[model samples]
Target: MSDSPSSWPDLATLRDRIDDIDRQLQVLINQRAECAQQVAQSKMAAEGDDTHFYRPEREAQVLRQIMERNQGPLSSEEIARLFREIMSSCLALERPIKVAYLGPEGTFTQQAALKHFGHGAISVPMTAIDEVFREVEAGAVDYGVVPVENSTEGVISHTLDSFMDSSLQICGEVVLRIHQHLMVGENSRPDKISTIYSHASSLAQCRKWLDAHYPHAERVAMPSNAEAARKVKGEWHSAAIAGDMAAELYGLTRLAEKIEDTPDNSTRFLIIGRQEVPPSGDDKTSLMVSMRNQPGALFEVLDPFHRHGVDMTRIESRPSHTGVWNYVFFIDFKGHTASSNVQQVLQDIGEKAADLKILGAYPRGVL
Candidate 1:
């Protein structure tokens, strides 16, 4: 622990120590994998074909504990992430999981999927958000990941609207910090760039930066940032606004990095699956409520939450296809459906609303 070189171990000594630690780590990792396999075997014996290998709540608890017990140079998030991959690998030994996301690869949604499920889960790219939902609903994939909202751009209406007709439940959530980068293909000149392409949300997220630096350049919105990067690959006078993954995938050079207007620009993604997630102690419940076209209806819907002391985090309204001027409210609250207070609040709101749908009660984002 001394700062002076004289008190520190030599470089060779440190290397040997690290090698010994690495060997121990390898054995421990394999032991964990063996334990995971045993867990799977136990489940198969107890429940036969009905066994559920992935428990969102249990994983959340484990990761939280990992972060809490961490005492090292690595940050809490960093330690948690390391354990995340370890858990992911162990779970794969039990049973590999397939995940679908809105993408052609190198998209933020794909990153979110990988972040939440780790590289062990097979990630399949879908062309649209709705398609991602369809895949999960049809049992083509075990789960799906889709953008729910952004810190800067607000709610993703398509994802919200998709929930209206889908039976998929929110198993978990992922919050990914978005970093926008301006990049160009090898053939493109930095000074000669006249057109820029990116997803609409990415473009909006970096609007101010673009105005300042590429004031005269044309901004074209594409299907996704990855697509934008792909498009610019053949254009000499165009550049792409995307993330590091996209840049690396398309072999583009960053003209500027972290160009988003907001420094903490982030996106929240929801994990959609068929099974309901049990309470992870810390959880969030999402609901879709429909109200009759009447005065004070919104107040009636919200009054119960206030009365029950339940913290409502977000509320977004979308037009209901059922009737004219009808709207559906998507509400997220800080508690599980199993909680007594939440049950009481739901009962009160059920009496006031035309229809109440429990979208999902899921663990809050851990990473």
Candidate 2:
């Protein structure tokens, strides 16, 4: 063959250049890991304990600082995600972490678990929320991620109830913006859809849209959105309401995107583990309190927060199962238990309330 007149370089020369680039990247990654190893060593030495391993607070602070200083075409979040994986891998080198979440896979809870632990650690998906907590408490998993509250639907009561007597501590937290999607099989026709399937919560969130479009269609509540998507195979007359990840997992097509009732809908998930996380500068503490059914009883419980200048982020009451007209209040505040102000406030509240339990203290999620 005649020599081709081309703008491209020779194959051998291009291959050599690519090899050199790969070598450089490899070297840089190793150097970063070595530095992380040094950090682990230094932390261990300072504590005078060789058994102590990874420090999540220090790792979070490092990622936050990198995100803060990051200036490039890549956004801070993108940079932080990359560093998160790197640190996760390094931590695995020290000790492999096991995480549990509610799932058969592809659930938002699984996504939150991955967000906290990255791809290096082991993730176990339980069939129920209580199973996640039980796994953590039994030491089957190093951590667990469970839904705490939804911006639109309010708190997940099962998660709260599960923690009432569990010894597991909340080590971290992650908030995921929930974007519901209309998914169908490849052979399914959007206009021909006659029925829909989804978890009760997911169906409720998309109630308005479903009512407008498929008012006459049968709405079936499945165990989970993933299960719903899996049920509708090639039926052109059926559709499922689920997250994008669930659609992808089940090989379904997205008929519509971002179909949630509210644009700002999001769900916050808690990461439960045995160890208590140190303050990440910006942190939140969750507590569940049972107050006596008396006038101004609630005020007396909250008085300590106001006196200490602690900002209350959220307060919601659930019917106490003990008897008629009884209630338990769940409170979230913008401070860590490790902080002096929060410690004093908690002490005061502890003395005033009938019962109080610190659920967890974790870094605030990045919006």
Worst lDDT window (10 residues) for model 2? 47-56
Candidate topping lDDT? 1
Q: What is the TM-score of each candidate against the true structure?
A: 0.79, 0.74
- Stretches off by above 4 angstroms in model 1 are 1-7, 151-155, 179-203, 206-264
| lDDT per residue as tens, model 2, 61-150 | 888899889997899988888888887888787677888898979877889888878888889889988899889888787888998887
lDDT of 1 by residue, 166-248 (tens): 88899999998779999999988899999999999889999999999999999999999999999999888999999989999
Clashes of 2: 0
lDDT over C-alpha atoms for residue 78 of model 1: 89
